[model samples]
Target: MHQLSLLGTGLIGMFYTQSLHQYQPGVRVAHVYSRRKERAEKFAADWDIPRWSTDLDAAINDPHTDTVLIGLPNHLHKTAILKAAAAGKAILCTKPLAMNAAEALEVLEAVEAAGVFHGYLEDLCYTPKTLKALQAVQNGALGQVLWTRSREAHPGPHSDWFWDPTRSGGGAIIDMGCHCIEIGRNFIGKQVQPLEVVCWADTLVKPIDAEDNAVGLIRYESGALSQFDVSWTYRGGMDLRDEVAGENGTIRLDHWLRTGFELFTETGMGGYVAEKAESETGWLFPVGDEVNALGYVHMFRDMFEAMDAGTAPMETFYDGYVVNAIMDACYRS
Candidate 1:
């Protein structure tokens, strides 16, 4: 069994640890670290972690730690990843990998230089409905992919670091919008290079330097156009909706529909509503805390297996760099 060390004890860390226990039983969270000693201890107790520490060195260098899962803020990602790489630990890092593309390059350089296995953690790809949508797009069930859109918005992150520009990067776009961008690129099988982008940021409630809302338009290398909107000011719970338009059909996915696809076919009269796609049992856990937790379960298991098989996992550090580069360009607009 591979042993894992987790950095940061925030919500993502909590859910990640829980999912590690629930889904990937063979993997063990042997150590945890946080600036807040009490938070580390709390997660240790809640998840039955064997070791907890406030020192980065201790957690990264622990004898039992074969891999490090970074759940820290955007700015801190570079520090944690470099430290783990230097310590000779394989890495599984959370999304929007760095403060910007340049920083992401630094992380990539460190990973390559250290000769370590690195993967970018993104729940967007692991979600059940997304998996189905990816299949539909790939199978040509949705022919001639024309346009796509995805949105992930929440009522601001609970962490103070997430609110700080220096720490969290740009805010809503970096935090929530990257997921949409990654998904769109993956589903359409296209390289997303923004031709023209326009973004507007707003500070709704948080006192941080980053924008609370952002929107952008992107043109893929495959000639597909996509637009996205993200916000930290939304009053409701986490909301994500995505749609794809094609020559023959359209596919729509929403959080409410769980792990199923809603298909619309082209008919002689007009667009005809077709059958609904069904997902396997336990394909998607309950939304909110449970949804996140389940995603990490798949995330870690795949990381471990890919490492053992000597293959890169679903999202590589390069993928992180691509998404960050696009976002950095959008921020410049």
Candidate 2:
């Protein structure tokens, strides 16, 4: 069994622990940590973890902990990953990797230098609907690709750290855009080195300097022009959708809704197919049946299997780097 340590007692951290306990029977969250000692203790009590530590190093150095899951805020991603690497523990870092590409690269370098396995936890690509869409596209059902668009956003996150630019990265784009951007890359099976990205962002909630809404256009190396609308101020409720167009047909995936694919062909031949995305195949998480993969359990499971085989999971530090780099460029643009 793989022993895991989790940093940060925030919502994501709590959800990850719950999922690990519920879905990943092969893994155990041996230690739980928070900057606040009391909170760490409480979290441990709630999760029934064996130990709690306010000192990040202690958790990293814990003898039973072979894997470290960094669920901290975006900026802390680099620091925690680096500390875990220094302790020789494999790492599973939360999405966005870091506030920007440069920091993401630093984390990648640290993991490589330590010769430890590491993966970026970008959940959207693992969502059931997305895997289905990717298969449809690959099977020529979607024809030659024309463009792809993905959007992931929700009314502002409940965490205070989410509103802080220094802590959460840059609001909705980093909070949510990373998912869409990475999903796009996974769908196309190529790098999305944005030739240019134009962005417009706004802040309407509270007094934070971070943006609550953003719209961006990205040109990928595959000659695909992607558009995204991410926001913390949507009144229509949370949504995550990706539409891929091809010469013969177009495929649409609604990730959060778990709806199956909608294919529209040029000759007006269109249909809807219901699939669990993974039910028909022995595909693992991020590739097969939903299996109620809520928190990071599926992600960890995928990573562990990949590690044993000496291969990287679907989403890696490089994937996170590409998303953040695009986000940074959009912010600058």
Candidate 3:
């Protein structure tokens, strides 16, 4: 069995833990680390983790830890990845890789030098709906792909640090645009190179240094176009939608708005329905097994299997670097 140490106890971290415990029985979260002692202790207890610590190095250096999964803030990704790489532990990091492509290159070099397994957790591309869409496109359901668009928007980020551009790297563009861009690229074919990017960004909702609303268009060498719009000002619940158009046919997907279960409440329902959901009361589209729906379960399971087989998973540090490079161009544009 592969024992893992998890860095960060925030929303994403918790979701990853839950998914691993539920789906990937071959791997276990043996230790968890948080910058705050109290939060770490409570989170470990809540999740029934074997150990908890405030020192990230201690967690990564643990003798039992075969892999280190990082779900920390954008700024801390490079440091944590390097430490885990030095310890010769397999590494799985959340999206965007690093603050920029330069930082991502540092991580790529360290992991390669250490010869450790690595995976990039870009869940949006792994969603069942997305996989189906891509397969259809590949099967010639969409002949000669012309354009693709993806949107991921919510009221805002769950944490305060995301408001600081220095910490979270940009606002909605880097935060959610990464998902849109990657999914679009997947539809356009990974081998295709993005030639140029045109973008427009602004702070439309929250008062933050980074943008709250943004749109970007990527022109590829194959003469295909991929565009995305992200925002932090959308009301109601989270919005995750995508579209792909080709000469023969078109594909449209609504990930969040799809209703497997719906309810109408007079007073208010209990708990949360989805991430960034304003209220659980009234008309609700409550998703069953959000971890499964969001593709976290499949992602971790595949990562563990890939590590065991000594092979790379669907997404890797190199993919993260590419997305970051593209986003950097978008910011510049």
In TM-score terms, which candidate is top?
3
What TM-score, over all chains together, does every model reach?
A: 0.87, 0.86, 0.98
Residue 108 lDDT in candidate 3: 93
Positional deviation of residue 263's Cα in model 3 after best superposition, in angstroms = 1.6
lDDT, candidate 3, at 107: 98
Residue pairs with backbone overlap in model 1 = none
Cα lDDT of all candidates, in order?
A: 0.79, 0.76, 0.91
What ranges in model 1 sit over 4 Å off?
190-196, 204-206, 256-289, 292-294
RMSD of 1: 8.6
Instruction: Give per-residue CA lDDT, model 2, range 10-79, as digits (tens).
Output: 8778767777787876888999989998899999999899999998889988998899998988778887
Candidates sorted by lDDT, best first: 3, 1, 2
Which 10-residue span in candidate 2 carries the lowest summed lDDT? 272-281
Error of 2 at 244 (Å): 1.3
Candidate 3 lowest-lDDT run of ten: 268-277
Candidate 3 residue pairs in clash (backbone atoms < 3 Å)? none
For residue 84, what is the lDDT in candidate 1?
A: 93
Candidate 3 lDDT over 241-284, as tens digits, reads 99999999999998886746778886777676777778867787
